[model samples]
Target: MQNYIFEIQLKVRDYECDIQGIVNNAVYQNYLEHARHEYLHSKNISFKQLTADGIVLMVSRIEMDFKRSLTSGDTFAVKLRIERQGAKLIFFEDIFNVSDGALYLKAKVDVIAKINDKLSRGEIFDTLNL
Candidate 1:
């Protein structure tokens, strides 16, 4: 299967920041989650469907490096790429940037797949069909 990449832009909201107006570290997870959801949506597949099929795409690990802080009203673009995928595992990478394309973060996520709702040891590549 061919590799897939997706991107989206989101504006930092005041409520997502701390007292100093800098976006909270936890908020970066939210941005990543949003980008992930959006990328899946583009594939015409949803987590609900996967669950119904007795499959679970669980995050096994996440690594994020932050280079800059984002404040309220700052618009940032997130680029997501499917680095690797299989029948029981998937790997992805992302870059978060500003309007001028100034990158602020780089993240990698590892996902493990389940069968009959149970985690397995092998890789799962079913997601590539779409």
Candidate 2:
């Protein structure tokens, strides 16, 4: 409900809908991921560079609560806010219908980093200034 640090608008595609004429439950994950990547990119973080540096960001967990169904052609926005919880970055992302300001989903994504294939204390995140 607070102002988000990052936001991306997207539209529901026909192929993303299920037989019930609503977006498939699993498809929301992809939307969330795309927003996160775009946010990081905007901050000058590149996954390719991280991999070349032997640093890897990984999703440890995700929780999503569907509040309303999204039908094909629905325009929505995915907004993100984040906090550092020790070695993990806890992301609070919410999806809202842009047309009516209706909340479509609420999600919490937990992300952790590994340096050289081993989990680290997330020092890299501190350097990120996120």
Candidate 3:
């Protein structure tokens, strides 16, 4: 298990599943994204304010490993930790089944900060103490 700084629990919805009766590949991205946004909110950072300040957080890369399938009505938690890696913020995120503690997915997301449409060194993140 990784050292996680934040976690958010979510339940799988029926519509999120495909004909295979498991969550579609694309739906997992939404779960990860929502957890990130919630983490920012917990730190008192507003995405709207960031945009007003000309600071844009963009996804440079994302790697997801599907270890197990999430079926409808399944409960899970998205756990994540962030670290500074030069000009980017690397998020190590994982999903696990809440009921059985089974690992469902592992993801690494690379986020780059842009100020005034130019790539930044992510100093803003440091000041935020995130």
Each prediction's whole-model lDDT (CA): 0.74, 0.95, 0.95
Number of the candidate with higher lDDT, 1 or 3: 3
| Candidate 3 backbone overlaps, count | 0
Distance (Å) between predicted and true CA of 124, model 2? Answer: 1.2
What TM-score does model 2 achieve against the real structure?
0.97
Model 2 spans with C-alpha error above 4 angstroms: none
C-alpha-based local distance difference test score of model 3: 0.95
Give lDDT tens digits, candidate 3, residues 24-102. Answer: 9999999999999999999999988999999999899999999999999999999999989998899999999999999
Q: Residue 79: error of model 1 in Å?
A: 0.3
TM-score of each: 0.84, 0.97, 0.97
Instruction: Quote model 3's TM-score.
Output: 0.97
The true-versus-predicted C-alpha distance at residue 53 of model 2, in Å, is: 1.2
Show where candidate 3 strays beyond 4 Å.
none
The positional error of residue 92 in candidate 3, measured at the CA in angstroms, is 0.4
Two-way TM-score contest, 1 vs 3, winner: 3
